[model samples]
Target: MPSSPLLPSRPSLLDDLAHAALARACSAFRQSGSESFALPPVLVDATLGNGHDAAFLLSCAPPEALLLGTDIQPRAVHAATERLAAARQERPDCRVQIFCRGHQELPQIWAELPPEERQRPLLAGVFNLGWLPGGDKSCLTRAESTLAALDFLLERLMPQGCLSVHCYTGNAGGPEEEQAVLRRAAALPPRRWRVAYCRDANREDSGGRAESLVLMERLPISRREMRVAGLCQA
Candidate 1:
């Protein structure tokens, strides 16, 4: 008999879980209806390495949704640009914006967006942490910057919006970075955010150094309510 479509044919990997989280977020957003927003909602790929995540997000995001991507390396930006060119052509209604910048600068970049775009709800974001594959290993994400970026995104994420972070703990400083991310996620108020950490427990490779995936979703509550409850800033 053929494998059931509902069940996975193979064990789920970190990427599989991350994409599943994103897909769920997209589905929720669609159910919420686009009429809630004055403009289409936005999705972000914080680490647009090779554009694979960006492509996946674009495929799942609602029609005309704006997809923003960023990378510190010019080569990565170029590669993603090329990789996404066909998708852009195929979906002309959807807007694609690529930036050659670090994730740490996300706040400043967001501040510079037009008022209308800034007002659009942030539906989802993806962050694949650590060094870029097939690139210089010396240039990798750090805890300080990554935390700063997460702070900004969490503050702005729309209620019911989700963010997926895949942290590879096998790289230099990776263990420290993963711990910092987990601490931050755990610190979020339960009334306002839902956070989950997934990893392979039985894996013995790399002396128990396994890739970790953190999934976070903002609960359905008004910003005003959160502020009134002292859970968020005014």
Candidate 2:
């Protein structure tokens, strides 16, 4: 006999027995081996606010892998550390490095790593600019450092990896910085980078309609060719 493509793959139950019962069982298996595949790449959370992003990064990779979280404010760093410490309760097996410096100095951090390690792929780099939530309002991410970090990311970001930018444009100097970043994003060529801009899902971001989330991916091709393709795509 021949099999029918439309037939069910699993056996069907015939008797209801005048009652219905359903149960689902989930079993989690423990994994002991270290990630043997080149440390599973690196991830950079440029503004590690509350450490949520850092914690998530650590969760995705094994403990020996490299994960970096950076911020310029001392308080912000403290908050991230505290948050990460809490996350350790759930994910005690992961490792992460935190930096308390502006993004403009990332090149120095990259230089400090071993030569062979520097060539490893970058998984993802994210930026949440503007002031820290419920923290200091006087301080914020500047355009200079943000752009510098973006340049570094664009150069070294892993293939198919994404960089997400969240910007707040209502505060002082925020609009100008947003404008500069938009111009820079607009200039990216299709051959080297693919971009998608979306509205933040939080309701708090609704009233202003000024906040934006920008995601960019580095393509496999060169910038010149990408730029030309972008012209044609338009």
Q: Mind sharing the TM-score for model 2?
A: 0.70
TM-score of each: 0.87, 0.70
Query: Residues 1-234, candidate 2, lDDT per residue (tens digit)?
Result: 888678552211210110011000000001312232334456787888777656655555544456778998888899999988866666555556789988878889888888865765565777778888789888888888899998888777644566777777677776667767777877888776787665445535324447666667665544354345331121
Candidate 1 lDDT, 9-97, residue by residue in tens: 33247888888888888887778666554567789999988888898889888778899898999989998999899778777878988
| Each prediction's number of clashing residue pairs | 0, 2
**Pairs clashing in candidate 2?**
190-226, 191-226
lDDT of each: 0.84, 0.64
